[model samples]
Target: MSTKMIFINLPVEDLNRSKAFYEAVGWKVNADFTDENAACIVVDDNICLMLLTKTFFTTFSQRPIADTVAATAAAYALALASADEVDVLTDAAVAAGATEEHCPDKRAQEAEVGMHGRTFIDPDGHQWEPFYMAYQAA
Candidate 1:
């Protein structure tokens, strides 16, 4: 198969804010696929994140919109180049209004699994974890 492209669709309360948040993390907006109802974010060469207004998102599914305040619909994890890079992504997310109180605890988790990561909740309550791991051959 040709190089598979990954598209992750997300529901957002405020498209403008979400757009700004992702942009703060260094991802470019894909103008060709962006409009009033949705903003397409280019995460990488083949990865795209489609941020849709909650109302617009409803048209695609029959299930009720997830109550991000009371519960989580999903957790997205991004792999970075190193432990420091993971911090850079997470720090940017926090600076852009994401919640990331899981600090030293997150650091402690790294010691147990040989991985480093941090979890942050976006303004709309979407959870994201930026991580790094070195997998050595056995």
Candidate 2:
């Protein structure tokens, strides 16, 4: 089967601010698909995001956009290859204005599941989890 690319679409109140936040956290914006109303954040070769202004985003759906500040519509999670990378990404997100989702004691849940990660809420209140999971060879 052919590989399918993933494009996550998020509606934002402020296009520039949201774009800046993503850029500050190290994701490159693809100008090829970006304009004043939207930006394409490249997470990788196969995964990316289309950050659109609420007004522009609404054109795709009849329903009103979810108020991310008040309710979480979904959580975006990225899988890292190493535990240290998880920490680095999380720290970068925090420095870039993302809020931690869980408390310190509960943030690292590696011991129980062989997975370590951190969750953060972005400026627009979108939840993101950067995690690492060790693959056990059978």
RMSD of each candidate relative to the true structure: 2.1, 2.2
Q: Candidate 2 residues 44-129, lDDT tens each?
A: 88899999998899999999888888988998889989989888888888998889887566544454667787888999889998
| Residues 1-138 of candidate 1: C-alpha lDDT, one tens digit per residue | 559999988999999999999999889999999999999999988889999999999998999888886787888888888889988888898898888957797678676777888889989888888888866511
TM match of model 1 to true structure:
0.90
Candidate 1: clashing pairs of residues: none
> Candidate 2 vs. truth: CA RMSD?
2.2
* Candidate number of the best lDDT: 1
